[model samples]
Target chain A: MDATPQMTCQTAREAFPEFLDFRTAPTARMAERSHLAVCPDCQREFATLTRIATALDEAPSALPSGRMRQRFYAMLEEEKHSARSIHLAAEREHHARGLSLWRRLGLPLAGCALLAAGFVGGTRFSARSPESQDHSDPEARRQLADLQQRVNAMGQLVGYSLIQQRHSPTVDRLQGVLTSASRENPPPQVINELISALALDPSAHVRLSALDGLAAHLEQEVVRAGVLACLAREENPLVQVSMIDLLATARDASARPAIEKLSTNVTTDRNVRDAARRALAQL
Target chain B: MLAVRDGELNALGELFERHHGRLYGFLLKLTGDRSTAEDLTQTVFQRMLKYRHTYRDQGNFAAWMYHLARRCTADHVRRSSAAPRPIDPADLNLHADDAPHAAGQASVHDDHRLLYAALALLDRDDREVLLLSRFQELSFAEIAGILECSVGAAKVRAHRALRELRDAFFRLQRPTPPVS
Candidate 1:
């Protein structure tokens, strides 16, 4: 009953590796023939392997049905559309996040600039006597301060402009307030007007609240020519500041003189005039 | 015909025309129920289109299909809810045609019925491996993917299934003793 009696005829398991692949290795084929010649047990195993390979070779391939094909194609198209919609939604969310971050950091600087603009743009403020101006209604000034604070935190002013456009704020009302005081000059009105409208506005610079809107208007040729013809003779430092901003991007032949006047140390303070001179040269 | 792969309905219809009768015959032998086997074979190809991406060119395509058939057969046993199921036979046939010269076997109607019953008694896993290898003759490696097991495991399971078949055959041949 000992199974050891059958061990002598047991085939080497080595034929297995070759049998895994249907292709017979030459050595395996020779080995298989030799093993089968002497070993009945191995012959059965070999025969079984061969039988399996042949049967599988005879087995049929799977084929899909008509209705199922239609469903799959529809699903793939739907997936592609969904992917694009998801991508666009994600892009807008990212842009919104950047605007939010700017508002978080720009508020304090905006407050200081609001004060600086009201006083006027230069060191000439320190030289002024305290009694020179009339006491004004503080309400409008306060509103301006608050807006300046909001704009400061807004990061890049370009995005704030986009926000303003989205909100549809009253540019005409703001221009009206500046125009009423234009004969004398309103420092904050002029600069804010130039920032919001003249520089980037569709209107002419000559149409600005003051000659200072000239610099912003210069970004466009019609505005540039209007600003030069109307404000090139104005000596106001506030007006000159806009001129500098205008010259910053100007290639015009007429913008050179205003730029040079701002640069001369004799007319402007050393630093302001020095910066203006460099800007003029660059232009 | 629906092609679940890429919605190629025409291709699937063509494939069905080429393969249905041949596959139906094989399944008929495998299940011993002409109608059930035909339905199951149709469903298998429909499901094939569903999982066409799983097919790889590395092995014989037919072997892959048989691996699927093995799974489907095992599933049919496990569910046991398939309506119109064929009645159990006293024995089952493993092969529908002539046996190898070594066995000098001739398959007749009696042998075929016994073969079917003997096959039904096998555990689903062992039954699949045996049918795929011994009946369908798929290589062990292709069977491994369908079963998600190693090739060595497939071989051992196949060998075990064969031994079970041999035992079942022996049992059917024994005469039961009469009660006192």
Candidate 2:
């Protein structure tokens, strides 16, 4: 018990070897424990180390202050707002870039995107011409460049006509209206719009045409969600199969509940249900 | 999962209010920094949000949260403390807490401070196992789940961590750290 300071440090060094093998060495353990029975130095060291370890566990920590929490949350909100603004600005810039090419032909595609407005409770409204809205007006360029300032005012998103108009380009213009439409187009919506246009077109051939264009974009989660929603309700088995096939491309686990429900529906064709199950497994 | 997916801010705020204290205390102990622990705690919740869909049930929520927290903590420790050239004296900083063994330094109060400083020297993993087992009141199975090890391995780990901790205490000039 009366070991020199150097002697105790040496004994502690020897004891550490047991700790090195502490996970597996049975003999090292016995030796260390036996040494602890007579050596007060080792015991003291052991006590101090564990006490800090435990006290740390028990020590109380304050939750972030309300101000800090607000600051963090506000910062997140700011990020989201900036993200949205940037998205909108990009879409505008895309349209603007596309229109710049069209405006070279002196056509009014800028007015066409703005022509989406339906006024006075479901009635169509267009005033005079862009030239009168005044073509000479300095604001005319601002109006043409105003995509960035604009917001999506269509609450229900039923303006599929503008989309149909936007996409159906005439071969007379071989350069075609590149319509920054390709630029900031939300890839998911572009797919769904194509699918909807294909399904509802007067000519079933165009519906098939729409499918070819949409098929390339089908391999993503957000796009698949729209396809699945349409498929679950589609009476046409052929369209249902196409939607089911598209679901195979989505990695979304959120589709499980819907897929599970579809699995049990007896009225659905056996072939379609089997496909849904197989696709469900992939997700 | 409901608190996360439903975007229920109140629900998430309550969850943060309930769990943040323990997570901060545990991470601070593991990393030994207030700011890093704070940032890591926030990162854990952000991760919880990112992978919310994988959550099946809330039955073992605490264990699951700790599972993610401990994994991230281990990664942090690994990045912060890398293995250097062969076991030099500096590598044995963990074992050197028992020094400055002057006589009569082992008072009831010294016993308190000595254990505190000694713990800072133990490897982060051993410190984690000891803290979770003894203070968090997690069972060996839960500890295994949190530590991502088997129950048998967790018991062995606990024993080993406790022994190393005991040795570290002796090196600190304290007689014996009181057992829980």
Candidate number with greatest lDDT: 2
* lDDT (tens digit, per residue) of candidate 2 on A1-283: 5334344444543454234322445565454456665677777766554454454433333344345466446644654566569789999978986864464333443444455442222122214443535546766556545633343322112233334543334321112112212333434455556656544544434444454455555565545665556565566556655666666665656667776777778988887788778878887
Question: What fraction of native interface contacts is shared by candidate 2?
Answer: 0.08
Q: What range of 10 consecutive residues in model 2 chain A has the weakest lDDT sum? A: A172-181
Top candidate, metric TM-score: 2
* Candidate 1 lDDT by residue in tens digits, B16-62: 55565556555654665665665667566756666776765576656
Angstrom error at residue A226, model 1: 55
Query: What lDDT would each prediction earn against the true structure?
Result: 0.52, 0.56
Worst 10 residues of 1 chain B by lDDT: B85-94
Chain B fold agreement for model 1, TM-score? 0.68
Predicted chain A of candidate 2: TM-score: 0.33
